[model samples]
Target: MFLLVLLQVLQPAGAQFCPDLCVCSGGAAELRSVQCGGAGMSALPVNVPPDTVKLRLERTLISRVPRAAFYNLSELRFLWLSYNSVTSVHPSSFVNLKALRELRLDGNLLTSFPWEGLRDMPRLQTLGLNNNRLSSLPAHAALFLPNITYLDLSSNRLTILPAELLDLWFPLPELQKGPVRRKILGLHDNPWLCDCQLSMLTSLSSSLGSPVVLMDQLLMCSRSMAPSGMLLTRAELSRCTRPSVQPAATRVVSPLGSNVILRCDASGYPTPTLTWIRTSAYTDCCQQNLLQNSEQPPRILESFMQGSPRVGVRWSIITLNGLSYQDAGEYRCQARNMAGTSEAPIKLKVMGVTRLSRFPKRKPKKTPFKSSPKFRKPNQTLPEKESPFIFPPLKNKIQKV
Candidate 1:
């Protein structure tokens, strides 16, 4: 077998010395390329060949590349910077690479990118963003990706494809007015939540829209586990739904003056806001005083934003303190969002206790006369009805000294 080699010519100026710990080679005459992978350099090397066509810098320590890093390389085409510590990128980093075609940015920590920066490159075709930590796409991501024929977003933390993306990519004239192109989209290995809105991707047809070739076998549900592991194409998203209050278990019988924590977990699109409301009409835990007319109806005992992605996950916690006889009633946790409102009831039963002590007891004193009420001793145990001691319950989680 005969091997073909591209001729390499070295110009006399600064082209003779290659960048430290990097291998640079290509034709200096018409087509040039630079191979600088695994250099262990922390910054973009200075003085790259001006006529470099292809540049590879995989597995390097380069953390970031500012706007003017590759400003001079007008003939640059293919660029690879995968497996690096690149956390950010300036909008104008590729402003001068007009002849660029393919761009690779896999295995990085880019949560978001500048979308308007793509207006500079009119000839862009392919883009790879796999193996990254992207949770959500920008709303206007479609405007910047109109000309893309191939896109890869696999192995990321994406749950739902935004409605904006679905309407813009398909060829339907009513949804979006643009020249529709048959594109190959890679979205495997993502924590894709099969929301009902995602049905648009799998339901595209050639008559009214361009044929979308979604890899359904590889598109398994991530958050809500299934037994058969159905594909996205066959999974009826409308049928594939669950209530906001999953499992729907909330009821506690905490003792009087005892602190109790009521859990309210919700799951829905656009994340739900959790709030606790006392069902009784008379009072609530947040009521400052019984005599105040403008008490504002207790202002919801507690409220918190459930920490989770806007998909099938969990909600927040609510701690009710110093349970009293009045607090023994129905408490409902309401979760409301743009989708709708759902509530879970917590029936609390608070039992009264006159006294309870964990302190060391004292010995009884000798009663000389039996006429008196039997000379009560400190060591004597008080029955449920006879004890006169009543202590305030704890306010917070920690015990007060």
Candidate 2:
């Protein structure tokens, strides 16, 4: 009875299982390891031993993965489905593979990702989603697989990190508990925006005490360099990805109006946080009350003339209203997040509309009044203004008058 039960437990699904034509090996392996990769496989075989430990199906022509394909594989651990033409992964696929650990899905044409499918593998650690067309990593990605230490998400079309993804472990509260640390976050090949949206990534790199590795180097800017050129190196991406810092030199541009924006721009790791502090708080205290849009304004101002906040490639805008000379002073914009803090000083110079007196007015010189040609009468007889001319033409012409 014990020998019969052991044979039943070791048996694969279905009776007299024959290796499919898609797999190169003819199921001749007496053990569990199988090498079925690159045999023109369009779909997973219908019958295979549940105890198969290593399954290699890479570089095949498989397009769609069927649901319930990998169920009851209690012993399957390492699965390589990379370098295929897979477009979509059904959510029900890989639902029961509780022992799956390392899965590689790189170099595929996958446009949409099945987050639900991968999350089913609770014990998953290393996930490779590199070289795809994923634009955004959905929120709570880290939460689904908390044990994931090696994540490779390089070479995607992502313009910016998701807004809620302030940190790698932002979604998982336990991971954000300050003492926790991740081994690696492979975010290189993706087109990352070098703006404040990526401040968290930049700031975390400094705290990590090393440069965040992209594919070939560190970070590749989405907009900084040529598209087809070599990947950005660690040094080139250092300043670009670091959180913004305050500039030592301050510049003040005072414009005309009751409302003015004290513009602050600087560079550092973890993009600088902006906070406007009126140095002459008591003197221009009334003006502070007049400041409009006190509530958090949209991140960027649309008006071309208005100031914009400086992030990786651009600037951030802050508005101030009811300007006075007292409003002019050192106003600090403090930028802070989990990584670090950066304070940029904006020396406010309130430039109101130039009063006529304030502007040097030309003095109205007393012009000698000249009689108008229309109003003047011709002189009829100029009698003895001087002695009448005696000789008419002494040297040249005879007097015709």
Q: Of the candidates shown, which would achieve the greatest TM-score relative to the real structure?
A: 1
Query: Candidate 2: worst 10 consecutive residues by lDDT?
Result: 298-307
Q: What residue runs in model 1 are displaced by over 4 Å at the alpha carbon?
A: 1-17, 174-179, 205-211, 215-217, 224-230, 238-401
Report each candidate's C-alpha RMSD, comma-separated, in the order given: 20.0, 20.0
Q: Over 4 Å off in model 2, which ranges?
A: 1-18, 21-31, 170-179, 199-203, 206-216, 224-401
Write one digit per residue (lDDT tens) for candidate 1, span 146-236.
7878788888888877655665566446545555677767787877776554554655532254545544336767655332456766665
Candidate 2 local lDDT, 340-391, one digit each (tens): 4445565666554434556678975644444345433475232333233432
Superposition TM-score, candidate 2 onto the true structure: 0.50
lDDT of each: 0.66, 0.58
